[model samples]
Target: MKTRAVRMYGEMDLRLEEFELPEIKDDEILVKVISDSICMSTYKLAKQGKKHKRAPQDIDVNPIITGHECSGVIVQVGEKWKDKYKVGDKWALQPALNYQGKLDSPGYSYRFCGGDATYCIMPHEVMELDALLPYDGEAFYQASLGEPMSCVIGGYHANYHTNKQNYNHAMGTKKDGNILIMGGCGPMGLGAVSYGIRFENKPKRIVVTDVDDAKLERAASVISPEFAASKGVELIYFNSSKENAEEELLALTDGHGYDDVFVYVPFKPVAEMGDRLLAFDGCMNFFAGPTDNQFKSEINLYNAHYTSTHILGTTGGNNDDLLEALQLAAKGEINPSVMVTHVGGLDAVADTTCNLPGIPGGKKLCYTQFDMPLTAIDDFEELGKKDELFAKLDESCKAHNGLWNPEAEKILFAHFNVEI
Candidate 1:
């Protein structure tokens, strides 16, 4: 049997290739991938190539399939696993292979295969453990959102402010505390906003900041309206690129700063801004992961000491967090659909990851399979058209001034073919 996969050939180069599927062991099951969301971490590694710590260190380096967030139906269960997972059961797979007591999992530490393919083999331990959640969603994209949402839950449960003596504090379940979502236009950042507004009882004010006006507008249209007027949950947008970003944030908080600040961008400058905007007794959760060996920051120690500010970093999710994220997504408490700004099949992913990050707003989602075959195309051709296309898109975005609409999807999809 043949499978399609996105292979990382070198720095800034990933190609979709066809490969032969491995025979499944009796203790394993074969899953036909339904949908996959491109992870920011995966995009970073693909761009960095050899510099990535998680990249396999072996001869078989080229053609390494690259995807992590994925959901699929159990198509072929092995003999011993027949009773454990039925052939038609829909489920999501957590790419972390370390759940079986190994130091690392297949997708992360080695070239064990990933979800950007037509089919994958799940080990017994992965099927029974890790972040796999049963799926009953209306679309495959919703199911695939589990991984990103799970990571958010992990950050939420990291107990960021609860550990330090002076800085230890909680945002509580009430809506009185102020929460700032840094880089609020990205996928994880947007997810944090949804969680804060919907589950945290509509915080006093849910402030979202991003350099891109389009993304900030997108967040307001989709997330802000969910809160009731009485909750006093206001969605405010700030351009982090401005010289007065800190001053603006302080003004929003009545000069006190935000109670909880979630840092969703890995850029060093963004991190510093988060630390500066943190309110006294505030907890700054570094929700995004920096690249390997790329630490860059200069914080004010005096301010931290006097204000009792806290900083914390977290990555990957535990099983419990995944469960909560899945439940929240299942109930529509969190809307993953609003954040999906781009969608395509396997062939479009390499280009999607290469350019999506540079785009001004919204999460670019890649569909593993599509109802119709997308014409095969090259990345260079797509990149060549980006300048012209981006201009038109930007104009439309400015005219609406960040309104949420399905038209953005049409614009993005029109630029890329969606076949493998």
Candidate 2:
């Protein structure tokens, strides 16, 4: 079978290419990808073209597939996986496959068998050992959310603060605690907001700050009324670009300080703000993975010590976290689809990643099947007409209770095959 995937070979270069699938082994299974969400890691690799430390060397040398957060249905199950995962069963494919020495597991260690492809082969090591969520739900978003929710769960389990550097597992459960999520408008930050709000019956206040007001408003709408009312969680939006943003955060917490702060932005300024806003004994969770060599923040060490503030960072989640994330999504506790503001086919992924980060909106999802059907015009008059078309679409989105329309979808879809 031929599958579509984004291949990276050089800096700021990505191409949607098709590759031949290998025959499944007795201990493996073939899955047809249903939905996959674009992650920050994907964006980094697509633009930077740097070899990820965790990625296998072979993947770096060869053209590698770029998606990790995805969900699919089992189409062909080999003999060994027949009893465990039958054909026609929907499952969340774990991205991290630990192929110690054997053929690389799909969607795991090798960057080649990613979710961007139409079909991916999973070896027994990944099939039997990694997390698999049986999708008995109505939507595919639940399965797709497994990748991220699992990371949050792992972060929860990895102990935010400890006397011994690597031996503690103290999950945050303090009552009346407040969490400040920097860059809360992004998908990861929004997930943190959902987790901080919905986990347990504990009443917690979540304040999400971002530079873009539009993105902040979108996040606010998702957590409105029902989730906020039931969880006793208030989702407050703040503009971090403002001069007195830190002061604003202090005022919101009544000068006591935030109990936990999740830094979702990778820039240095955001990190500094997180360090400054933390209360005594508070834990600052660095959710964004900064560049490998980029030590972007200058922390106030004196304050960090005197106040006993804890700072921690985490990567992808383990198997347990992935399962829990799927379960939560299954229960409709978190709507992963709500984060999807834009959707296009495989060809649109490269341009979407390049431009969407600068756009003020939600996540952009790439569907591997459909090819966008739109024509491009170069005349100035035609360009003016195109601008009008987009304006009308934006108006329609706002008018229809905040839903994306067909025209906006077309515009986003058209940019996929643009010359890079």
Q: How well does candidate 2 score on lDDT at residue 281?
A: 70
Runs in model 1 with CA error above 4 Å? 59-62, 100-103, 109-112, 162-175, 200-202, 225-232, 370-420
Clashing pairs in 2: 97-108
TM-scores for all predictions:
0.81, 0.81
Cα lDDT of model 2 by residue, 1-420, tens digit: 777777666555667778787787787677777667677667766555546554445544676666777776788888976667777887876665556645343432454367777777765567656556576765454567668777766665553543446665457534577778788777777777777677762436778898877777677786663567676777688888888888989899899788778888788888888889988777887878876665767887887778778788887887777777877777867555455565556677766665546644566666565553122211213444567644544565555345443344444435443210
Q: Every model's Cα RMSD, please?
A: 6.0, 6.1
Q: Top model by lDDT, which number?
A: 1
Quote the positional error of residue 59 for candidate 1 in Å.
5.8
**Model 2 poorest ten-residue lDDT run:** 372-381
lDDT of 1 by residue, 1-420 (tens): 677777776677777777787788897777778677777887787777766766765414544677878877877878976666687888876665555366444344434357777777676667566445577765566667777887776766563444345643454422476788888777788777767666544568777888877767666776665553434567676787888878888898898787777888777887898888877667778877776565878877887788777787778776666667777877867766655665456777788776656654455566565422222111223433766655554454445433223344355446654321
